[model samples]
Target: MAESIIEQIRALEVLDSRGNPTVRVFVTLEDGTKASASVPSGASTGEHEAVELRDGDASRYGGKGVRKACANVNDIIAPELVGLDASEQAMIDRLMIELDATDNKSRLGANAILGVSMAVAKAAAQSRCDDLYRYVGGSEARRIPVPCMNILNGGEHADNSVDIQEFMAVPLGAPAFSEGLRYVAETFHTLKKILEKRGLATSVGDEGGFAPDLGSNEEAIELILEAIEKSGYEPGVDIAIALDSAATSFATDTIGLYDLKWSGAGRMRSDDLIEMAERWVEKYPIVLWEDPLGEEDWEGFVKFTKALGEKIEVVGDDLFVTNTKFIRRGIETGAANASLIKLNQIGTVTETVDAVRLCIENGWRAFLSHRSGETCDTFLADFAVAMGSGHLKTGSASRSERLAKYNRLLEIEDALDGNALYYWK
Candidate 1:
């Protein structure tokens, strides 16, 4: 028996769904098995996330070109990683981190490192003739996540007046993952029709969700509920609502202050924001609220969690950034009851997996997420099931980039051959 080793590694600059430049990596094993992975970027990115290298030239793509990151992968990372055993995931990731030797992977670029990391995992699975979930998570990877399908978009994701970053639909009553996706997709279409009939702009945001200037956040909630009902689903019973405030987008330097430019409501204090959120929670059946406070406002997080954490999932995205240290800090401070897991935020599959494990170990819910600027890579779909995270937020039920993930989950469900277990089940 011969060991499968990395025979070659290649990288290139690719355009994400948002038309932004991103890095894609290809890994080939000695046994001729090959796998490729692309990295996604975030618009409302956290301050503490790993560095994504970009070309600073003002002439091309407004300095967003990832040619430099691509070069780093080809010239730097590939040389260091080639010939290593493809099955050694943790070891490969650790070596990449050490080679970078920066707190945030600034030298080689997280985009480059993460691309290789994910590609290697995929290649290892290919070499073993196993699904990614089985290869990465072993026998325990059976739980299919409940999709948190975003139906409406606001904040930095859209050019609209709605303040909420994302308004999502969760199919909690569906018996299978595929059925749950269908329910959400129908609701998304129904919502589009409602928006169109109301003479609202049905343009999609960066994450494939409708971006309509609905005047108020309350209106967004009402429209979503109406859409669910119109789609023949019972709101709060068959399907539930979730929100991603992305408050850091409007966070000001002054503590407890926020500038909501969209609502024309001007600046609001932390207490007022919490009160508004509480009112919504009371009025609507929102099962999850993510980043309801600014990343730097630990006190606000504590207050919000203490107020409504028991009733709804107070998830931390910018607050945690999929970093274990920050996750531990959030745990100690009672900042949030759940953590959003974005693989690119941590820059490696192993580190991302570690973060999910930490959340699970501490009884905190883990939700695998996709970036607003995404590719057609369906990695997160497998990853969510593999980790048994039970929840997934991968944009809305539109766009090829977003649909690729949902469609892949459907295929996985079929492949599971009756062994699949959905989150609702």
Candidate 2:
């Protein structure tokens, strides 16, 4: 146990996939075991999420520098956490939360706190010579998530006219993680070819999904479905569609009134958006609808859930922010059927798991997810399996950063030795 005690912690300012400055934390144990983790940034961040600290210096990284966060980890957080046991993950996380003493980790920066939290867990797992999933989720952690490949991008993630943020292809019927990955990877290729045939741009967005100027949001779905069928797969049975409206991105002006400026759909009330969802769910093989309503639109969410909750999974991303407090509200109010779990949203691994437990224990599902700006670290793949969350949305098949997660999941499935499970339910 003494050997697993933390000996040193440090942080460095690093660049995310978007070339913006972010925090990367490293931890060293007394026994010479070391691990590191990089924090991901969200382009479409929610209003209530823990603050990702950034240096306001306009000179460095265009004011997105995270040197303050790195300093917090090296100067303050590192000194206090040095002698703690790496294996005491929950206690260590709680201590950090207390140290911050802020509601949203605004002072210390979620980037700083989460980087350390993730590195400590990775170091502990290395010290035990165990996988991170097994270390955090016990030995039963072998459920590889059904990958929801974001093949089409819109809203904040893309400059296209389409309003939906993410249009994903879920290979729910695939026998295993590797096969499922292959299935979607093939579909991604097919979609690109189809777009080229129609004279659309094959360029991708921040999350690597194609960002072509389409006629409308529904047209993106049409292209994806066509690709799924053309790739020798059935629509709903073999591949299901998932969406992330990321409504908060568009919810910039008002609380209840939504401005559909990107799609030219005009300003709409909550009911109008709900009606469109009802139509889409009936028309397409849509299995999941994320953030159908904005974060503060609780009543609208409940109404949206009631309308389509039985038909599909109504997921809350910005609505929940991977925090147990808002997840509890969603659970109690019947606002959403599931929550999108992002590790950095809540600033600590323990709280992120707590959010998942809150959702699952209350008969709701957890959709482990990645941010738009991501790192090559495969912690998310292990985390999705660890939580037994049936699904995860990384990105399209093009970028190496996105593929890194899928490649890691393939490795994990093999590591499970025929014991791994994959499903959407």
Candidate 3:
């Protein structure tokens, strides 16, 4: 058998769903098998994540152009990666990281490196004539994750009055990924109707969730539950709620204080935030709460987890940033019971998998996530199933970019021929 050496690697600058420039890479194997992958950018990004290189030209896309990242791939990375075995995923990723020689992949650009990394995996999978999931995760990668559908958006994701970042509906009772998506879609439409009837604006946010100016965060949760009930589902039994505070967006220099400029509820302390979260948990069927505290507030994380982590999932997004070192620290300090896994956060498929493994090994849950600024790439759908992650957050049931992931999951479920295991089942 001849080795599947990389024949050519090329990259291009593309526009994402948010109209921002991103990097896309194309890879070809020795035998002519080809594949391509694109990288997503995040709006509510963590401070410690791998750097996403962007062109600083203010005239083009407001300094968000990724032409420089694309140049890095075409000029610097392609030369080193060509002629290497495409099937050696870890070695390929490590070589890219070493070539950059930066702690956060700044020299070669994480966007550039991740584009090549993902493209190589896809090419290798194509060479083997296997699905991306099976190629990346092996035979046991048959479990489909439940959708954490973001029904409403606020904070940086939207220009709404609601302080919470994301108000989600989790279809935990569906037996298959397709059915789960259907349920969530129905609920999303129902929510839209409720907002329309109330004379609220039905515009969407960066992640395709409804961006309505509801009076309070509690009102947003109430509307979602109402929509769930109207869509013919029981609140706690058939569907559950999830919240992504993205609290770092509202953080201040004060250790335990937050400045909610748009929330209308100003200057809330850590205790106040915990109390509010506790009330929400008691009143609603919220199974997950992500980034309730600012990323640097470890003391608040410990307190919040001790208070509600036993009954609900306390997830760390900005806190861990999908980095293994931060994950280990979070595990040791008992900061959270779950971690949000974003491939762009760590900049490679191998490192993303390592983060998921670390979370599982430490008895923590891993929730695969999508960025607010995303592309049509459905890699996360296959990755979620491949890694056996029980939870996935890919915006709402609207927008083509968000729907692309759900549609891919539907295709994967069909391909499984009833052998796929859903999260609820």
Model 2, residue 68: C-alpha shift (Å): 0.6
> How do the residues 331-394 of candidate 3 rate in per-residue lDDT, one tens digit apiece?
9999999999999999999999999999999899999999998999999999998899888999
Which regions of candidate 1 are displaced past 4 Å?
1-3
lDDT by residue (tens digit), candidate 2, 339-360: 9999999999999999999989
Model 3 lDDT at residue 11: 97
- Residue-level lDDT of model 1, residues 1-425, one tens digit each, is 33479999999999999898999999988899989999999999999999999999989999999898899899988999899998999999999999999999999899999999999999999998999998988987889999999999999999999989999999998988888999999999999999999999999999989999987888999999999999999999889999999999999999789998888878998898889989999999999999999999889999999999989999999999999999999999999999999999989999999999999999999989999999999999999989999989898878999999988888889989899998642
TM-score of each: 0.99, 0.99, 0.99
Model 3 steric clash pairs: none
Question: For each candidate, what is the lDDT?
Answer: 0.93, 0.93, 0.92
lDDT of 3 at 367: 90
lDDT of 1: 0.93
